[model samples]
Target chain A: MTTTTIPTLPAGRTIKLGLSRIRYEVKTYFRQGDAVFFSFLFPLVMLTIFSVAFSEQSFGSEAAPLSAAAFYLPGMLAAGLLLSGLQNLSIDIAGEKGDGTLKRFAGTPLPVLSYFIGKIGQVFATGILQAAMLLFVAGVVFQVELPSEPAKWATFAWVFLLGVSTSAILGIALSGLPRTGKSATAVIIPIALVLQFISGVYLGFSLLPEWLQNVASVFPLKWMAQGMRAVFLPEDFASLEQGGTWDLPGVLVVTAIWLVVGLAATRMTFRWIRKDS
Target chain B: MTTTEPVVSVRNLHKRYGSFTALDGVSFDIHRGETFALLGPNGAGKSTTIEILEGYRDRTSGEASVLGVDPGTGGLAWKARLGIVLQSTGESGNVTVREQLTHFAGFYPNPRDVDEVIAAVGLQDKQKTLIRKLSGGQRRRVDVALGIIGRPELLFLDEPTTGFDPEARRQFWQLIDSLKQDGTTILLTTHYLDEAAQLGDRAGVIAGGRLIDIGAIDEIGGAEARVPIVRWKQDGERKSVRTSEPGLVVAKIVAQLGEPEALEIIRPSLEDIYLQLVADHAAAEAADLMENAS
Candidate 1:
């Protein structure tokens, strides 16, 4: 063993823990092939399934063939983001927190705030990859044409970003809900399925019962999906419904509410380790 | 006891969990550069005290200072000076030994060089190997390396050598000694008495949320917890006596028995002292139980 004179160091500096945490997150996220394959890839596969299933169906002459497919494309994309963003995020974060990684970080000079920042960064970066993959497969295999207008693309970008961001916050908040990893899976898996079904990923919100639609709209998922359908489909496709236009303001409001709720949940929920909790 | 400032000082610390007293009026002092071992059995409030010191748990009442600042409110400056080696690592990862060390080093302002720390822990051969591939002992070395890489002035080691082989344990002792030589103060808690004896300048024994004994390693058990026990055969019958002066007792026994056969004078080890202390606490509790029953 070599003992060299360690140059004197000051202890007050902030540890750039975010970089390490982000690296760990990205690396570990890729290593979980089951989550990557099922959570991210399965949604792209779902896009094909949706496009093919809805390609020939006509919505009582108001909607043309493949028009319903276009409307649900963005919803499926939002679902893909949420699968990893909310479902996988909650499960993985809860698991890590349960396993003492968070506690170890608490002891270091590494700031916890940085970890949140890094998590957001990694999730968004991975979401872009998911978006790219979804767009590619949708264009090629599914014969689903993306919106070519700049205004619609702008709307799609805003809603998609807002959707994933809100979902990520919700993920962090949900992490504190389960004391153990297994319990987290039990809590999050059903919630993910419910979000997919009720939020218009598998079908339009109009197809669900009025009471369930009202209840689902109270959450961001429904508004986020509706907003995406508005963006990626024809301009008057929303008017083809009972409402002439999708509730743009509602998506903005619900996503904002989810963001605040997610942040508050994360702040309030302590990790598995507590001094006397 | 030369008027030197204590490195760690706690006064009247009280912690309670809904009616159960985890620590009650606990107080002690550890001087600079001294190894003060908090010795206790499971559920004896040792963890509570250590957690309070480590700034991981809050105290219900009273003042506690580690390196002259209360850990409960201590900020980054206070935390950076301290290094803690937890009982276990979090996960087995594919990150190489050097990679993990370097990653941990990034968290501190002034960390030891990555290669040097890996070498210091005697993992040169395994430096490039993934952490998951290493043996348990090698992984433990990585934990220690991360703890000391920041060149912390005060280190908290909790049962650090629990899973180490004998040779690795001895090497760990040498590393600790070298740290002491460099003027680092360590607060260690271990169940191993020999480790306490070999490393601690003073040992503090805690039982039932109370510090029952605290003194030099040699003085804790002898003449305090238990008298030295002398054993030998006396005319085909084995006899034992507890005495303050074990050497004198041995001399007398040798004279009477003409070089006593199977004779042995045994001083109380940290384990013996620990057991007696716990048993005494249990006996007191039993007496209290009987009194309350009546």
Candidate 2:
């Protein structure tokens, strides 16, 4: 055998590979019709249906009442982020694991972190597009007023980042729950739907029982919706909150906590090959 | 990097999941530039051994080394030295054939030209086609292309031609032959005994989680198993004799009985020897079970 010297591998190449992974991931995501329709367009469809159906209705206390479009806007935005980051990733990754994509990647020289970068990058790219479409429909088609104050926009940005980060990590961690690719949608959609309904995406948060409200508060979606409300609704509208305040700081804190928890969970559960394989 | 050093070595590897043993006390070595065929039936631990060597799965116990590094803790540099084609095709169907190869090619330090690999696997026409749209044999070609694009020193081909047509399988064999000429050490697992006979310099036959036999391709089942058998009908009785010189045996028989009816000499091929080996092992196992029961 001809003796060959193994080079000291470049440490910085992972980020480059990760960046390339994003391109393939985004391209692949748009090609899957089901994923494009459900994950990317589900929120817009829900927003349209609820806005037109309840055009005459208003939610919250009379002193701080908000129109249906305004009421559902924040809720749908939160749900959209959750769907893009958590629900989409969980199902997509589960399918990868089931179909041998993850197994193939595990055998290659590709870093595990690069695969994650691709996944999270796909979610972030699609999440932005989904958020934009939802907001556009709310602002023009439904005549819902968006936040004008730069401070409010600033709050929206952080809340959006935190929510997406937390949900995406949790999505990867939850991918292990489904036993097979065919079962992923069944396992993930129900969890996403339940979180949506209880987190006030489909109904008024304050209308639920106090006990249910407490239960909702324990998850990140409720805080995410509350944060979006702080951005889009009038400042005095905080009077209708469970605590009679938007609790913007609490929103950041809770979502950040979930982000940390999600990171830990993903570290423990993420696998290239299934246990049974 | 001595020429005598084995590229891969395993010492009494053992793996178990709960009560089921996947691989038990299996050991072998692949030298620098030889194609080593690992022949086995389904669930006989072929993939488990390959996966453990690839670092995709962990072994419960025993030591395994690939390219002088322990696979369980092999770094990216060590991994870059090897190419692997797993039993199952795993690339996403969404990406075009060329796109998938290009993506994987970026991961390695010394990668072959993507188009060259495409041609090598006979997928030049399907380069722009989405993998999902390709036929099963075509998708398998993509898997083979990806395996070679890394230009690896050691390649693991796990049942690579499982879905290929006869023509495609022949073309794949030629591709493997070229790789062999390049002095790339390969460890291949396949159900096709002809493929092993055509490509392997040496072989290891595994059965029921154990290495039943290991040696040069022609010598795997031992001399006794390969002895040519002469069969003839005499006095309404079927009879056969095993001998190294079937021609001499037939001459004696012809001289004795003036050409007895239904006479033939059967030269045991590798497939025949392999089957006999597996059957003998199964019979031994059944007898062991019976003995234990009593």
Candidate 3:
């Protein structure tokens, strides 16, 4: 029989649970072949295809020139972040909701905050691996040089962290938008694809129309792509940017603001069960 | 907690979704160390009532206390003392049974050994197999194992044996019987009346969103509903008499017709009484509708 007095849990129990959940999330995620191929491999495959296609081309002026492969490196990295953080998390969580995983957890003593920590931790871990793979392929096959200065690497680290964080939170918020698990990929893929294109991942940022660039500027993906470009491109390659400068400050402001917005939206929308269920 | 204090108390609980009333003024109490079965047909609000008590859904109006705390305001500490096996299995299909159990065991302060839970559910042979590869019955055992792994004081089993074979179900009943012996307060919901008879100490029968009867498993439909009937064929007509003294009625019949043809005494089973109660309630409701229409 249940005791009249409820027992208090040990201190740091939630943290321990959250940390263990990360292992579960990662293990389960890698087991799904479809999730791995689509979220983890799609960007790398695209980079390989694009790099070979533009092998003969050169970007930037003679003073600080860049090969076409190096130019597309940052764009592919940005797309990888979006795929791993936003696209993957949204679809995964929506499936969890539709298939009753969230409902099961809701009945347990697991804290909702801990669940988020596990998810975001997954995104962070996968994002690092995706970045490393992208960097390796770029360096070995394409002979693209990475930044050597500690400041440039420092910028890369923060940008990667902030971009992944913002995308993950927004993904959780967007999981509520799909009506069913079957329809989640159908709804999320188009949105992610459109963001990538508009944010200068698949196409050149300056080549796009002013109105389209302005629309992309309202989103964090555009800033994230620009920040990646700052870390990887030559100093004089700033001329290719819309403002003829690496707007690192602007990237920070926009990504941080989206992080806040994503948090607010998730708080408002996340549910263990669907509205109709 | 004392055995006299109800582990679960529900009063005037009502739940409405739009114009549809899912649960209407349902009330019951389940005491400590007792298994209370909520029996109903599909869409009879059994799940809704259970969900409200499990803190998964909110009631429109009601007073519900589970383990001395209102479910609406219960925290993680309160949830830790309860185990819920939802109607549909909700575990991730990617992990093995042992891995899933180990993961969930970490959530509770005091949990049963993962291997012991596995052995209890008779899944020792399939413990290392991925859950997705398991058969329906095996998957259900995994569900039961997860529910008991936390060593919950109060366990809620919602249609726990839905897909089990007869032999597996019997094995499950034995496991539940052991848990009962351990003094766990349990709330079970199932459409199988025999399951209720076998496991429940008391039952609440719900139909059309209302509890039609509540009492001990054998005495649920009242003494009147349980009266034995002596039936016979005489004068080319079938005759039957409802009587408490079924033996006396048989003797009187034998005296009158020198052993009437095809004579037999019919004692109502729980299933029969339950069906009769639901049918009578439906007839009464139809009459009320007709009067209102007129």
Q: Compose the digit string of candidate 2's lDDT tens values, residues B1-294.
A: 687778999999999988999999999999998999999889999988998999887899999988888888887788888889988875459989999999999999889999889999998888999999999889988888888888999999999999899999999999999999999999999999999999999999998999999999999998899989999999999999999998998899989999799999998988999999999999999999999999
Give the DockQ (C-alpha) for candidate 1.
0.28
Give the runs in model 2 whose Cα sits over 4 Å from its true position: A1-6, A58-66, A274-277, B90-92, B230-241, B248-265, B290-294
Candidate 2 CAPRI assessment class = acceptable
Q: Chain B alone: TM-score in each candidate? A: 0.91, 0.93, 0.92
lDDT of 3 by residue, A215-252 (tens): 99999999999999999998887887888999899999
- Weakest lDDT window of 10 consecutive positions for candidate 1 chain B: B1-10
The per-prediction CA RMSD against the true structure, in angstroms, equals 4.5, 2.7, 2.5
Most TM-score-accurate candidate: 3
Query: Which ranges in model 3 have alpha carbons more than 4 Å from their true place?
Result: A1-3, A62-65, A274-277, B90-92, B229-266
Give the alpha carbon lDDT tens digit for every residue of B21-69 in model 1: 9988889998878889999888888878988888888999988978767
Best-performing candidate as measured by DockQ? 3
Chain A TM-score relative to the true structure, per candidate? 0.87, 0.94, 0.96
DockQ of each: 0.28, 0.45, 0.49
- Which stretches of model 1 miss by more than 4 angstroms? A1-16, A48-64, A67-72, A240-242, A270-272, B1-3, B88-96, B125-139, B222-230, B241-260, B288-294
Candidate 2 lDDT, A1-26, residue by residue in tens: 46645666788988999999999999
TM-score for every candidate vs. truth?
A: 0.88, 0.93, 0.94
